[model samples]
Target: MSENEEGTPERTDVRKEEEDSPRDRTRLSDICADVKISEVMSEETTVVRESESIEDIIELMTRTPYHSFPVLNENDELLGVIGQDNILELLFFERSHRHHHTHLMAIKALSEDASTLMVHHPVTISPDSTLCDAADLMIKHHIDRLYVIREKKLAGVVSRADIIKKIHGLRRQ
Candidate 1:
């Protein structure tokens, strides 16, 4: 459809065929395997303290674009993740939406601090891990993002959007 640098007409049909070939798929997978998590993750991540009150966390949710935040202890160790689902319990006072009333939801509703309210043992990946590893973990856990942990501390964060963007960029090149 267009002329290349050599002043010859480029065969777009053949190029399209090549893109859909198994070799190209293998190349893409190789790129994913080679790319590290630290290269694609956001280092300047927003986090919350475990001791922070529910009011403070609510305020933070209102101010930030993030739907979830990694909860940290005084020593900066990652404790858990506090997401919108955890905060939604506060909206209902006496009644729960589930068919069977859950005692855990009621406890979450009564929780005062981030530590008690947060979801424990959040899915995490190491910064040293590959982008493919991150993708696999996210798919297995059905999560949109993963907290990058190092030495039990929050190192960074990688999101599904980040991986998609990286793949798109590579394709363009």
Candidate 2:
């Protein structure tokens, strides 16, 4: 017998079966294939304002193991980056000076201000960028993290740790 005008019985059954089935299980190759930065990025990222004091920044770093932070302006625009190394250098400089006490006091004073020593114009990336692109940028710049931007706004962060995690996960399979 001829099928109905709407849809043939066999076709309808096939459509229903396809809809009932779950999405195809991805292979390890598919998971690792051209992985995008957004796929592995950490959505929960710590940020610091440009006006924040160095002392406060140091305190925040102590609370977490974050090696770097993206500095933002009052409008939430990325201004630069400040890494733990920079803070350590400042501390070392204060300690080595002949006028140790004066230098210590000066360091303390400088820590209260943000713009005095913060790195300006940090490297940034778009959320849609591939993981390979982010990794390349990190290697080229010798940076540990890349700020993910979406529509000119901070979206998330892609760090070396995140990339390592992806590699670890892939290795398990």
User: Which candidate should be chosen as best, given lDDT against the real structure?
Assistant: 1
What are the lDDT scores of the predictions, listed in order?
0.85, 0.73
Question: Residue-wise lDDT of candidate 1 within 1-173, one digit each (tens)?
Answer: 78999999987864775677534777888999999999999888789999999999999999999989999998878899998876886656466657425777777778899999999988888988999999888888798899898888888889998898888777767
Candidate 2 lDDT over residue span 70-129, tens digit each: 777777777777788777866676565566556544654466555655677677888777
Regions more than 4 Å wrong, model 1: 1-23, 98-100
* TM-scores of the candidates in the order shown: 0.81, 0.66
User: With candidate 2 superimposed using the best TM-score fit, by how many Å does residue 59's alpha carbon deviate from the native?
Assistant: 1.4
> Model 2 Cα displacement at 78 (Å)?
1.0
